[model samples]
Target: MIGARLREWARRHSDKGRYTPVGIIFHWVMAALVILQLALGWYTTRMYAGGDRLTAYQWHSDLGLLILFLAFLRFAWRMMVPGPINDADKGGWQTNIAYATHVVFYLCFFGLPITGWMMWSALGDGRPLYVAGLVPWPQMPFGGLDPQWQWAILDWAEDLHQMFILILIILIPLHVGAALKHHWWDRDDVLEGMLPDVKDADDHREGLTHKPKRPRSPRVTGAG
Candidate 1:
């Protein structure tokens, strides 16, 4: 009786919070940008040092600006919303890892782009990075840091950005694998909570609400 009542309460207050397309857009768009940036980073680092490409520097400057704008909005949105927490997760180790990785991911996404902006601003060229005659971008290692010191700092920022992302790639799979484990093995709703496509079409169609006989604590156990 006690357990059942607890569950009903849990259902009443489940963190199945609705998400804005901002969240949706931020998540995927950042993913796309990061992948593109990785490729661009490689191309520019080589091309700048002398490889072959028409205006590699120009492209890098422009893209860095794009990253800066997107990341700024993403972070602001994250602050406004209390994100959904999946119920299926239930372990300290896993939970901790997820939290840490997410924090790091945000840092990398923001830090890299911002630094690039600083670099460009510091150059004092005042020329905006653009492509095909549209879309303006800012630079990083922004002017005023002094050439000798600025060069070293830029190198550090570049190296740090790459290292964090490499770790990020590893974390991505661990996160997905854990969610899937809960779905198939535990037969839980962790995966259901995140599906843009309804995995629980039945429950959804039944009116998006379940009146559990009992309620559980609003406590969440895993990554959201």
Candidate 2:
């Protein structure tokens, strides 16, 4: 009795697709960009402590600004259009982890840039960070204060920024693994929603002249 009611509810709302897998490709692409930033950030830190001297701090500053810009774009994108629910429709631990990890990801990615902005704004190495020598972005200005304490605070912020990136890198594999598992093990196209140029189910249905099968696919899959 309860199962039948759940089925009816799903049928009614299934036609209306969610925000995920829209025309935007930022979901996957930005994620890849973040991972790349993490590696560069780590290398930057090592060089900051007199590792390479000339080239050490240079890349770090540039990447930090890039991180700031990317975070702004990513955060805006997320708010503009929340991603669709799991493609597999298994809104259990998988859903919970995916959501939680993403929130943490945002925090780490955004925190680094804002802190970096503060760092550069205060103690710039005599020059500014720029993109393509085309535009000069202003850094946040903190009024006159003790130089010693300010440097200490900036150091800590950068440390935490690196720590969070490390945490996120570890979680990414698990997150991606789950998405693929849905297609490989569960045989679901939940992953297809965000994949480029996928054939929407509704479109596939339009071409079909015959009625649907008893089960949605080869077998009954998905927990909810």
Q: For model 1, what is the alpha-carbon lDDT of residue 209?
A: 40
Candidate 1's residue-wise lDDT over 1-224, tens digit each? 86566444444334564234446567767777777877787777776454355367667656766766777777876764545565534568877776777787788777776666555555566666652236754354346667777777667766766676677678777877877876666655555554443334445444354322233355776868
Per-model TM values vs. the true structure? 0.66, 0.68
Which residue pairs show backbone clashes in model 2?
20-84, 87-190
Candidate 1, residue 221: the lDDT equals: 69
How many pairs of residues in model 2 come into backbone collision?
2
Q: Candidate 1: global Cα-lDDT?
A: 0.62
lDDT tens digits, residue span 58-117, model 2: 566666666667667768656654455446446777678877887977787777667666
Question: lDDT (CA) for every model shown?
Answer: 0.62, 0.61
Write down the lDDT that model 2 would get: 0.61
Lowest summed lDDT across 10 adjacent residues in model 1 is found at 207-216
Model 2 compared with the native: what TM-score? 0.68
- Stretches of candidate 1 off by over 4 Å are 1-14, 46-57, 88-91, 119-127, 130-146, 197-205, 208-224
- Per-prediction backbone clash count: 28, 2
